[model samples]
Target chain A: MKVIREKPAVIQRPHNFCAGCSHGVFYRLIQECVEELGYSKRQIIAMGVGCNCNLTLSKIDTVDKFQCAHGRAAASATGIKRMRPDLLVMTYQGDGDCGVIGLGETLNAAYRNEKITVFTVNNLNFGMTGGQMSWTTLEGQKTATSVRGRDCAATGYPIHLPEIIAGQFRPAYAARCAVYDPKTVAQAKKYIRRALEAQINGEGYAIVELLGICPTNWGMSPVQAIEHLQKKALQEYPLGEFAGGEQAELAFLRQEAEK
Target chain B: MQMAKKIMMKGNVAAAEAAIRGGAEFFAGYPITPSTETLETLSFRMPEEGRVFIQAENEIASINMVLGAAACGARAFTTSSGPGMALKQEGFSYAARMELPYVVMNVQRWGVGLGMLDSGQVDYLRDTRAGGNGDYRHIVYAPDSVQELVDDLYEAFDVSQKYRMGVLILSEGYLGQMMEAVELPPFKEIRRPDWGLDGTGEVGLKQLCPTYNMALAHELLPVRQERINRVCREMQRWESVETEDADYVLVAFGLPARVCVDAVRRLREEGCKVGLIRPKLVFPFPYDAFHRVNPNVRGFISVETNDLGQMVQDVALAAKRELPQRNVPVYCYTHSAGVPRVQDVVRYYRSVLDGAVKEVY
Candidate 1:
């Protein structure tokens, strides 16, 4: 017998995203999770502005997808979750979409502990909008709008969303992952899986912020961008779990179920 | 079968009861004059009925919460007056863009600022045409009587859900505060759509919320235009009284519309040919229906209670386009900063009919 292999569910066509953009890798990881968890058929992927908006055109099997107004994907996701709680719901948003325009809805959802997962790709700049500085834009990063390196004194510091959400809402599972290298990509997969698992267990809100690399926007080659992310960005945004006592809670529930 | 009971109730209370009878499961709002009773009534009744009722941090939060709940497949609603309505505009626009079905009751008071908590239909301009951003249209109902208010509430929810759009119930301070007889309807269980975000277990579906998408915007213009066209085609309704033989048409809505009816009767008694055309759905503004009336009408007297003549402009535009050569003069009688009485509208109608009044744009 011959075995036929295929690309991961996350990989799709009309790939207009610039080369070395982490969006493709993140998409693959998310698709893989849905396939592994048996949620593929019951999942609805909400794709928001920036690079993630391309997900709407992607042909991901068993996952219905739609696009919403900029910065409002979280609120739409909230509506979707309320309307169809049985489906595995997730939103693919960028830093500008999640951290800026959608800040209110995002924070409110976390506070309310809505049962949904938000996969936020924080590349420090609004990559899709001609590399403008975003809420998560690194202090010294240069972009189209910020011709001079980002001024922390004048523009305020980068918003550490995971830390803010963890401090305030304490969601079921919250973590920051990176996609700078193969190892971090694997680590990001774990965090994404954990967040989805939390939703499956009816634990609460889960958010995974991936510190991705936007090579084109950053004015660096793909390899150099990865190295830059590892050397510069990683220091400011350390990877780790920020909230959710879900691991302990899940264990307790399992014990009780066994009993 | 249970017989419906008729009782006099304030417009706001009737609006609240209508929401409950319409199977509204979640309500979030902040207290504002003339509209506070809606939140108060829901706060007590919702919990008792196993519905979710919350007093949100502010008008913005309240609308957002309702949007959240409505997205989750609950029949959701909120109520407010002028200033609060202004604050809720952003959320309202998002709700429309996302295509969430819910009810918003604006118990109107004078505005542009901190206009007194008096009965006024000035919000007609803001709420009717484009209270929110985008080219999307909202299903609007202006109720004069408490019964009409209740009836409109039920219809508003049905229209909202069927069309996947926001519905506005435009009432005024007088309607919100005045007591009137209303017949109560039996409660029915609301069957939520499979798409709402109640929780993970109930519907076995993912909660979808609205997000901004620039890529979609590239192709959004045509798609949005089509939606607006469909809305215009399907959702326009109007009510007219003594329009046949009358030479003058009085255009109004909500309490002002009710006053126009009295003005029409008085004008007829004074041997002037006058009639009234009341718009039930303000957004898909009933232009075609208004055009069907006799063009022999001399002019239209727009009675509004706002300083800025908003709805009057819509009426004038409609009249000019529809009945261009009826010698139709558009007269604006604005009770700026106050509600116009029936006698005041009758006086305006008489002047317009007798050709004694100089048209004020």
Candidate 2:
């Protein structure tokens, strides 16, 4: 008998996401967590929508997935979770998708502390639909609409989602992490793992905000974009745990249950 | 015949009972008038069943919490009315677009702003057609009696789960406050699968994630719409009554439908040729069924409790497409402050039958 040693569900689709996009990194991290957790491919239900919406359906093959509408993936995931509490469900959203169009959903999910993990990629700008200033865009960040730097007086201040969510609800795990470099990327993965593990433990809502680089939208080379994220974005959006993990022993026990 | 126990249950309580009996283990809702009872009841009962219940700070957060719970594969629900429902529009839209199976109870009151907790069906149009800004439809069920309210709770969850769509239980202030005898179904414990986001079991590393992006979203629209259409076609169930020998039909839904039925019976007894068509599922509109009855009926009367007869417009559109050649004149009885009584509906039906009614639109 031949033994297969690959994750059952990831498709071999060529990566269309731009370099330094961080979506690819996020996807890999989620895939790694699922693989390590040892869940059956068919048991995993995924939903996605908006700019980075179809990323999962095109790449992941081992799980049941649904592509939802703009900023509505959380809502659909809510329904899925209600109907099939046995299936691992999660939603990956972008800053524009989650913060602006989906702010209500993000806040509500956190407030209710629903047992789902939200992976939010904050590139500050809307990367997919030309560079546009999103709600999370920094005050001086330039974009298609704000050819001039984003003015605090005109565009409002950049939203700190993790802080806002932490204030609203006690999620099982909440953190703002980055993937601009190897160390932070590893840290981000750990946070991602913690959030997903929270779901497995029925610990309620978990979220990870990845301070990602939008090379295309930022008008910087991939290397320059990483450097920019490290220097400028990290200072404004610090990376650290926002909630839970106080019971490290309990979390580890629950994490081991997946293996 | 056995005497049914008279339960002085509010509409919200009935809805809550139905949700609990139907195996809803997760409920997140912010308190609002007319619908607050549903959340209040769930807050106490869910924990008894080892379910998750949260009283969110606001309706926006309430609906989002529902989204989170639903994503974890739990049977989740939320309840609100008028303004609260409006606030929840974004989350509701997300639920529908994401193809999530959940139930929302809307105890509608009058309004464009902070519509008072009055007995009006003003939200019929918004809830039925365009609650959120997008090209999508929700499975809307408008129950008239307290019994229907309770029965439809289970039906709402079942339909939502089967179709992967959001189901709206549109109740009004009258129904929410009215007391009626109800036979409660035996409660059954819902067994949640390991995939729910509750984080209790071993999660596989390959589970799908919920995320939105434009490039990926565009590709799924065609498939998603196709799925929606399929669900709409298969699950378009409605409560309809007709007399084969009748000449006219009175079309209504929710509480107004009950009034229409009373009016139809009174008109028929008075030697008039009028019947009734009460739709239970208001979203899928029952166009084909309406068309089947359209040819035989001489005219139609639309009864609602809104300032501008919103549902009447749907009847007109259906009549235009269903019975184009038939001169089916529609008379609307629009009242915003309160639901028109049975006598009021009967009066309108009689006038329309007597050719003495004036067309408002």
Candidate 3:
């Protein structure tokens, strides 16, 4: 018999994430990409607050990881990468950790074009904290605090961080991908690999926003949550690379001027 | 005897150069009053020495950067003042809990919330105790002058890693800005600790804290207590002047201590038995020096530059602990924001001698 599929050495045991949650899937995808791209031994992850820290309990067998303070993973990764440029530094954060409280740190890291990778799990709400309304929570979505449903007029619209980062700042790579289905999961894997390669090539900062479905938080079955993420969340956060191309931003500027 | 080369420079620049001499490879900080020179000097000096230096967007980012560097076992630090240091308490607490070694030079400003830029000792209580949340203690060094500032900061890295804890250089605005002739320490090459996360997964998995650390907290309590006790036992340092057979002793640190030295001399010349005890290490409180003071000492005067006198309470505690048999009176004299005037400190001592002022403790 031939070996068709096997778990990477980076992931030594089953993760402790909720059943049917996309966090474990994205975790496996990242480990697989790290194993595939040959950075299995030389990558450091600055893990942020929120469910991202839950990965610490997953018994990651190898690869260095620092559970950074809330909202400061990008800044911490800056120090790790700056002190030792030989190592690949990355940040794993949640929507609340990266797009809300850490907006300043995340944006400043990109503004400086620090040579690091950022992977944010956008599950629409703050999952680990009993499903509070997060920066990425869509309008009309009900959360713990927004029990009446998120009112855009009052709470404002969902923040598109990757879009904001890619549209304004100059990163080496910036893309958003969903993991609700097999094809989308494969697409997420490619974006994850591209973000990793961007750092390995020393091109500069790279970011990939992974859209995850929190079935427990969304109060839906695994199947229903997947459909909701695809049907509703996808509209607010489109999947594509927001940053890339030779002088596309300049072209965008000139085209805006003409319009 | 060989003479070390001496140069005249400001305290902030001296701290920056001394950090480099102390084997500090990374520095992250935001520009704030008095302490800004340290950040400014290192901006160019770090890259010139092939080291890392970043002017982060804010103090939160700066201290977290220091945390990351220290997590990698690299000697790193950040410089800030009162408000900025308050901003850094979270990162400081994280570094303390992680048992990571780093240093912070807090050139203190007086008051709260966008405090004045003048020199003061308002942070004396906060820096010696836990500045952030939780029950943890880090080493605090108080220097009286520019030369002492250079010396303390030079040895900060060694002392921090020796105990695997953070170190705070409790500097004052006057001391950080004043120019003085000082001999900088020699540039020493030290090896980074091997237990840090090198990011080479070739080694065993190094979880840089919290989950496993939280689990280990119960087991780590006694270890932390013993470590702190050991630090307190071995790291007590201070200057004792005419403390033998004196009737009263003047206790102070940093810039205020400089004036206390003068007050002590003037009092001694006037047929008075006033002595001086200047603590070099504020956290340990120099209880050992208090122990060796005149047994017949009538009172202890604490000179400070902050409102309501912060260090006076510590002075009272040390006095009460060292001489438990009798109730000793502790008087406080605060110059508020600026440096204490020599005459004011002397007059305050006179008032204490005359029993015109009430004892605070």
Candidate 4:
């Protein structure tokens, strides 16, 4: 079979993410989206300090990248987008980076309707620092910080960033998707593409939260991690476009459902 | 005699106009007391001049906005006072270490932790001596007048770009809120070189900042630090008035320096041989200026607004560097309770002259 889509040449190295890690999946999707949309040259990605930070080490020669202070990616991206509105600006962050440490910056970016794209990956735990309890870790999930399983009473519940952001009217697009299965991966890419489109169209503030998998951190096999995502992560974070559809698109969908 | 137009305005407004005149195209700031006029003026005027101005959600976001804009090679700036400056320290340090050139105007309000809206010297160490974490120093300037504020800020952008580091204009409430006539400089076009990330990324232009990889830092930091040290050494600036044949020299900066100058002139009229050494650039604490003091000078008095006499420590260090064995006496006449009084400074000089006050250091 002739290969219709090859690996993006921009990502030349063997990815440094761990086995069953969803960061690779998201990074590949971002590369493909940028490549297909022909924004590879006019794009700048602000990388947050997290498990996905290794993405900068890959040496993507075409696209510009900035290493942001931990949890300051949205604020930094705000600067980049405001200064160079001609260029497409985006920030890639993890749950702890956005939801916990940088929640204020993320929300304010939405409030200001900054014309930028933000991709937040929720892998249920902080996978880079040997799997600590992240802001998106489930109520009962076990990790390095919560060895005896998380207690919602003390640790609080996992934050659903997509839902929180979608509730805000300023964002041109906001969505939550996953990378557990091929079908879900396609949904993730669609949402990611739409988020980028919002930025391209000059619609302000686009965010997409991707439910990622971390097999090593979760202490499970790669297959088990996928199953765990499907069973638990999806149950909490249903895959759908929470925002960004035009009124006409919604009207058409409603009419089709009536038929 | 230069044909420059003079305008009557508040010092903070003068600073705002000076920033625009200095080719600063981007500004992001949080409105705080004593510094709000700068932001307020820039909000409307910046967009009118086709520049970017943002009333950031907070000081942290404001500095980050500057960091981002500076990364694009645009001349960016921000203004804040005490608490707000504290919030901006993280981004300031990041910019310093990344070698990103930008300007910061700190219209200092009197406070440690929200103390007062009046002018007090609380951030002497915080502004000049490594305000942020880590082992890095940036250029710091304290102007004594509205004209000096305008002139120094015009050069501050150049110094910042030349050094590729953040430069701070430490304006206190006394200067920021005071009304004075300032001659603003003419506009100059700024040039952005073929570097930075101003959307030429396809040709492979990149700006790296805030490193965490210790291995890469270990190899690169020492060289970068050596370059910074050399620049700091070259940029030492101070104003020494009448120390040629004096027995006592008063060390001060900013508002205190203005007061000390008045006190020194009054004491000279009273047949006392006193002088003033006012530091313009506080960080590259002019150690060589102390060497210029006459051998007959008996003591160096630091008249400051901070109660702890933070600048006195630098004065001692600089004095010791010049007179290691001679024991040049360093004394402090601080006024943390309020602004420094010329009478108090004059009184302290007389006490030193009369051998009534002993030099502790």
Candidate 5:
């Protein structure tokens, strides 16, 4: 007998995201991974003050969810893990929430190699705040704050988070993925599963940066948003496991050889 | 049976030791002037007791860590001075809303906006009145001496948890940096709460959410307000010395209270009718203690090391409740950040008694 589907960790509740928002896909993928990993009963999540974060509390009533101060999900998660190391703890943050305002907490948590998972929904702009320029906003991209297209000179450049995490020795896993289409959605699921697995195994900090869609904030239709991710986001933030590059491959090879 | 050893140590170190004795299993703190030794002591001592200690990246992170640990049923605390305490306001507000019981120490310093790293009590208003924005109040204890600092911290954990609120020990640098011999309390083993967000993975049990946003506002706000009011009423603690039989009452707290107490004794020895009323618990202001004073006490003088008396308002209000018929003279003698001069306090008490100091209208 083959099982094609299983229940997810998220409870059956209506989400509050805008139509065509990719946050729903990320949420579903994360819940599926949690359900598969048998962490549904012992999962604790720290939610950032953002649109996607709000849905996790309202929709995902099954798991314990803590609401963190804007951009302080990492710090709060660190507290949970330190106090209750036996439990699985993770944080859900957005581009502006994780990258700019809470960059200190985010980076320090990774540097400390805290045994937790961080899932960042990078939508290029601050979606909940009506499309303001974020640290992850693309060059030449026009947001409410970046009226004349983001100037590379004035706003610097979009921060490459996975690249930065990969450069660090603390994070055992760090990857960038998108959830635009069916294939990419499946790939995003794998990234989320692997990140959770790393935390479960106490392999130090793990992070998965998901290039999510904000159709309303981007001023695009569902189709246009998918196209933008496929064409632009994928080019700028390449999808792959950036951190734990050699260690993960070697472990995989060793396991295959042993088998 | 062996008695506890009394060792001469700085007030900050004693505070750290007292926290450990009080069963604080987790300490997340950032180093700041006057209060740094408290964190430094806990950094090494906490781990020895199988506790968690983290020197956080900043004050903001430290306080957030406290909120996290406290949510999971761990006794956690943090210590800082003026600038660091200012940075922790956001986390404190969150802790108050979530009702995460913990302790925070503000070793007072002079000035505002990166003020000098010396002894000062100008932060009395901020520390006792709302340190953070909101209609929330913290259980603030102003310990005047090294022994009082250790004693307050020793019982701070239970008191904080009893009310499910944050407790603050507002000690100035003079006490925090000074050394005194004191007996330490025995270690306590705190029982874990049944309702914690640790996700024990047990069946038929739901995970707990510590933030107020997750709960319905209309349902939670009223309950939270009621809990706060009840706790405030039950946690009012203070001390009144010679106030029962005196012509004039002197109100002071923290470091200045020590000076005022000494000044009162000296004034009494010199055949002057003066007494002291010191508030151990600054928050909930100990209004009942003022009402207990002799109605014959014609005046009240508030002595503080802050710029233009902060606690004077509370003192006057308490006195007003005591004597509703006639206007009682309330005088404020402020010294800002400078070290207290006992002579100055004595002179003010004499002037008020002689009717030389005009009543503050």
Candidate 6:
């Protein structure tokens, strides 16, 4: 077969994530979107501290990249985009950084409708710090902190960021996606691309949550981890556009019916 | 009423206008008492000048916003008071590590912890030192009057950019709230350094904390030290009040310095050879001014607003370093959260003159 698409120049080095890590896949997709959007040189990204730092470590760069103090990426991106309205500003963060440490920053950035794109990877736990329980850890999910599985009564229910943000803040766009299969990966890319588009059109703040699997932390094979995500996690986090869609629920229902 | 071009402007507002004249293009701040006037003034003025200004949700967010703008090479700044200044410490460390330059105006409130909304110099130590985690010291400007505040801030951005480090303006609530006939500087051009983030990645990835590399830091450490030494060598600024031929010298900054001047004049009239050393830049703590003091100077006193007499420590150190042969005593006169009256300061100096007040160092 003839070689067609090549790796993005932005991905200058091999990433340091684990064997079944989804960070690499997500970073590649983001680079693709920036490339496709024709802002390959006119964009900047602020990555919150977490696995997102792997983007900088692996040399996944933009015109400029800021390794913002953990959880301050949203606020930092707010500053960047506001100062240079001509440049496309984006923030990449993990669930822990977004929901746990940087919660105020995330919500306020959305509330202000800052013209920046936000991408949060929800791996169910704080994967980088050896699978500690996170704000997004599913109920009854075991981790470093919650050895007996998560207790919703004690820790509160798993946070649904896109839904909360879409409902409360009325952002330009908000969506959740999974990367278990090729089709889902394509759908996740669509959400990411749409989130970028909303910012491009000056619609205001946009966020997309990508639900990816962690085989090492899940104590399962990569294939089994994907299965776990499909059979169990999917029930909790229904994938669809949550905001900025005319009939998001209806489209979600139709998508479920097709499956 | 505007007197010629000099307006009777509040200190904080004058500083805000001076920042605009000095080429600060971006401002992000959380409203805190004492410093809120600066934020409020900039909120509307920035838009009128077609610059960027944002009221962030909290102190951390505001400083981080400034960090982002500074990274892009915009002249950015933020303002806050005591507790709010504490919240901004993390962002300060991050900016320091990134070697990004920006200005922060702290209209200092009194006391520790939550402190009070009272105008005082309680933030002197924190503002003069690293003020955050790790090892970094930025240039600190301690302005006494509204005109001095305007003048200091007007040059602050350029100084920060020149050194590529944070520059702190230590403003007290007393100074911030009071009005003065001030002349603001004329508008200057905003600068975007060649190293600043432009649309192109031509400079390559502008790395954060290059000092993290031990090997690179081995070479970088000396350069960093030299910059600090150069700052000390070049930026020690102060105002002298009758210290040319005096047996006793008074060391102070900001509001205390203002009162100390009056106290110095009164003491001089009372047949006491007392003078005042008003430091305009606290971090480069005016050792040079000690050169102008009497060679046979009998003693030095630190006049301040904090209950504990914070700046006195620096007074002792500077005296020890600069007046090694004199071996003179260092005294401290302080007020608890309130600006001391000139009468009170003069009374304290009389006690010192009579050997009734003990020296702190």
Please give the DockQ score of every candidate, comma-separated: 0.16, 0.17, 0.68, 0.63, 0.56, 0.67
Candidates' TM-scores? 0.84, 0.76, 0.96, 0.95, 0.94, 0.95
Clash numbers, per candidate = 45, 65, 1, 0, 0, 0
Q: Over the stretch A1-259, how does candidate 3's per-residue lDDT look in tens digits?
A: 9999998877777778887888888878888998898877888899899987878767656668887889999999999999879888999999999999999999999999999999999999999989999989999999998999999899888999888888898898899988877889888898888888889888899999998999999999999998898889999999988875324557878899999
Candidates in descending DockQ order: 3, 6, 4, 5, 2, 1
lDDT of 5 by residue, B1-361 (tens): 8998889989999999999999998899988988899988998999999999998899998898888888787888999988999999998888777777899999989888998876888777787766677767788998888889989998999888877779999899888999999998898887775656857433211323333554476667776678767866787778788988888888888888888888988998998778888998888788888777778888888888877678888888888886787578788887787667889898877777677877663
Better of 4 and 5 by DockQ: 4
Task: Report, to 2 decimal places, the DockQ of model 1.
Answer: 0.16
Every model: iRMSD: 5.9, 7.0, 1.5, 1.7, 2.5, 1.5
DockQ for candidate 4, C-alpha atoms: 0.63
Using alpha carbons, what is the TM-score of model 2?
0.76
Q: Candidate 2: where is the Cα deviation over 4 Å?
A: A1-14, A26-51, A60-91, A97-119, A157-208, A234-259, B1-6, B57-75, B87-100, B133-136, B161-165, B188-248, B261-274, B283-298, B317-325, B346-356
Q: List model 3 lDDT by residue over B70-189, tens digit each.
A: 888899989999999999999988887688889999999888899988888999888988888887787999998889989998899999988888999999998899999999878999
Off by over 4 Å in 3: A245-259, B202-219
Compose the digit string of candidate 1's lDDT tens values, residues B99-173: 788899999987668879778887886787667786556778887788888988876777788878788898888
Off by over 4 Å in 5: A1-3, A245-248, A251-259, B200-222, B353-358
**Chain B TM-score for all candidates, comma-separated:** 0.91, 0.89, 0.96, 0.94, 0.92, 0.96
Evaluation by DockQ, superior candidate among 3 and 6: 3
Give fnat of each prediction, in order. Answer: 0.19, 0.23, 0.75, 0.60, 0.59, 0.75
DockQ category of candidate 3:
medium
Q: In model 3, what lDDT does residue B57 have?
A: 99
Error of 2 at A229 (Å): 3.7
User: In model 3, how large is the Cα lDDT of residue B175?
Assistant: 89
- How much DockQ does model 6 earn? 0.67
| Models sorted by lDDT, best on top | 3, 6, 4, 5, 1, 2
Question: Model 6 segments beyond 4 Å from truth?
Answer: A60-63, A245-259, B1-4, B204-208
Cα lDDT for residue B99, candidate 3: 83
Tens digits of per-residue lDDT, candidate 2, B67-172, equal 7666566677888989899888877776664556678889888776988878888888888876777766778988889989999897777777776678889899
Q: How much lDDT does candidate 1 score?
A: 0.78
Between prediction 1 and prediction 4, the one with superior TM-score is 4
